[model samples]
Target: MAKGERPKDSRRLSRKKTKQKIFFDEVCRMTKLVPKNKLTTYGAIARAMGVDNYSRHVGFALGKVKASDGVPWWRVINSSGRISFRPKDRVGEGTRAKPFTSLQSIKLAGEGHTFTEAGAIVGWTKKLHDFNR
Candidate 1:
């Protein structure tokens, strides 16, 4: 079978599983990075942690982690510096895109990070670290 193909009856884990595992590990590590409110991209973590060809795998891994874990999964985003939109909520629950963005912005603001009218970081993370003294 090719890399993308899966055989029947063997219960083989998909290739995505491996990348997800790598992603999970990276997320766990990222959770430990200092100065809360600092955002890291999927590509940043992938390259820092040595995962090859698996930026989306980082997002997938974060989605799978349990909420009870307190993993700060919101900090990971695309390379273009945008946070991931929340997955559609369960029945009767409300959800919104850019949920993490607001939280991140608030946290960064407490640390004196600035944002434009469109609500971007505007070098907030670096500023936070610098302002921390």
Candidate 2:
């Protein structure tokens, strides 16, 4: 290898990390556009970023954001307009379990969002912000 040359594998890894950082930054920017009283879906953000159907990547990027960064991570939810919490584990005793209360729901409620008994957002037509529009 030349004195200034990096290993091919190391170069590829560096480029991958750089791309991930760019994706994460774009996700944060889109999340910021969701106003206090409005919401957007992970799929929507992915679409806005020109990567339609990459909702899980959107979620992964948002998960990397720190609470103090002011990105409003809670404003993003599943495509069905519900807070997407990981399901609680059920041990072998045959007892039902529930996931912890969603902080995203709490934040959205404080912004005046209403939910159905099953927890889908109500009046979604008016509340869901379309950044592409």
Please tell me which predicted candidate would have the highest TM-score against the true structure: 2
Q: What is the C-alpha lDDT of each candidate?
A: 0.57, 0.82
Lowest-scoring 10 consecutive residues by lDDT in candidate 2? 86-95
Compute the lDDT of residue 25 as modeled in candidate 1: 71
For residues 64-109, write the lDDT of model 2, one tens digit per residue. 7887889998888787878876333122233246544766677778
Best by lDDT: 2
Worst lDDT window (10 residues) for model 1?
Answer: 124-133
Could you tell me every candidate's TM-score relative to the true structure?
A: 0.57, 0.83
Per-residue CA lDDT of candidate 1, range 27-63, in tens? Answer: 6766446345566676666666666566776677677
Checking candidate 1 for backbone clashes, the offending pairs are none
List clash counts for every candidate, in order. 0, 0
What is the total number of backbone clashes in candidate 2?
0
lDDT of 1 at 118: 62
Task: Return the lDDT, model 1, position 55.
Answer: 72
